[model samples]
Target: MADELKRRLVHASGSGLVALYLLADYLAIGLTWQYFRYLMIVLSVGVIVLEILRLRVGLEWWLYEKLTREYEQDQFAGYGYYMLSMTAVVLVFRPEIALPAMLMLALGDPISGAVSDDSLKRVKGPKVLVTMFVVSAALAAPFLSHAPLAILAAALGATVADGVTIRIREFVVDDNLTIPIYAAVLAWLVLEFVPI
Candidate 1:
């Protein structure tokens, strides 16, 4: 439980990545969209290299043993998937869309995880799902308020990503990778299709 708590705390820190945009812009630190794009590119590439080293070279980090689940020891860890998904979200969506999606990942996932029982194979309980939806909707509302339907869609998308586990042969899809992308894509779709 202590280790799981540590993992969730680290997961919540992802909100700091989204904070880079707000703090930089307001502080006039000159983190322009193009620079952010470049940063994401660098981060994604770096994670790819690190993952290769970890998976292929038998490289082991101390944190890996403490934070990673037994299932993750034989495959890519969640943090690698996390950064890659954030990179994709930052690069593909506008700030209004991207920031909220990132929040869903940074905030919603960890919050839901705190309430979850990892022993379950699938379908988190209603309490966990409700918490995810409420937190996700609240996080997205400030950014997506211009379109109410889009907020619900974004929240629902994030909830589904966090609450369900999909296994593909040997791979289990990580919510770290799916939450932001799914939320962003769904919100984008609603915004694009249903005129406000």
Candidate 2:
């Protein structure tokens, strides 16, 4: 339980990226979107390199033992997926869509994870799904209040992504890589269409 809490805490800390972007833009700290974008790219690349070393070259880290799951011992860890998804959203979406999307993954997913019951060995139940939607919607509300449709779309996307766990052969498709990307895409679609 303590380890799970630590992992979730680390997962939630990913929100710092969005917060950093906001502070940088608000304070005119010269860490504009251009620099932030490059930073994400660089960080993603670094993560890929580290993942390769960890998975292929037998490299090990202290956090790897503490934070990784039983399934991650032989595959890409959630951290890699997280960086990939975050980088994807930052690179592909506008900040208006990307920041809230990232926030949903960072805050919403962890909150849902905390309330989930893996002992059932099933997808999250309705209550967990509802919690995910609520947290995601609240997170996006501040940024997307202007577009209620977009806000709902984003919340639904995040809830679905986080609630449904899929596996391909031996590899589990992680919500860390799906939640933000799906949420951002849905939000962008609503912003583009729906006659808002």
TM-scores of the models, in the order given? 0.95, 0.95
Could you tell me which residue pairs clash in candidate 2? none
Clashing pairs in 1: none
lDDT of candidates 1 onward, in order = 0.89, 0.90
Q: Lowest summed lDDT over 10 consecutive residues: which window, candidate 1?
A: 114-123
lDDT of 1 by residue, 156-195 (tens): 9999999988888967799889999999999999999988
Stretches of model 1 off by over 4 angstroms after superposition: none
As for model 1, its CA RMSD to the true structure in angstroms is 1.2
Model 2 per-residue lDDT tens digits across residues 14-131:
9998888889857878888878999999999999999999989999988899999888898899999999999999999988899999998888988998888854334789889999
Which prediction has the highest lDDT against the true structure? 2
Model 2 lDDT, residue 58, Cα: 98
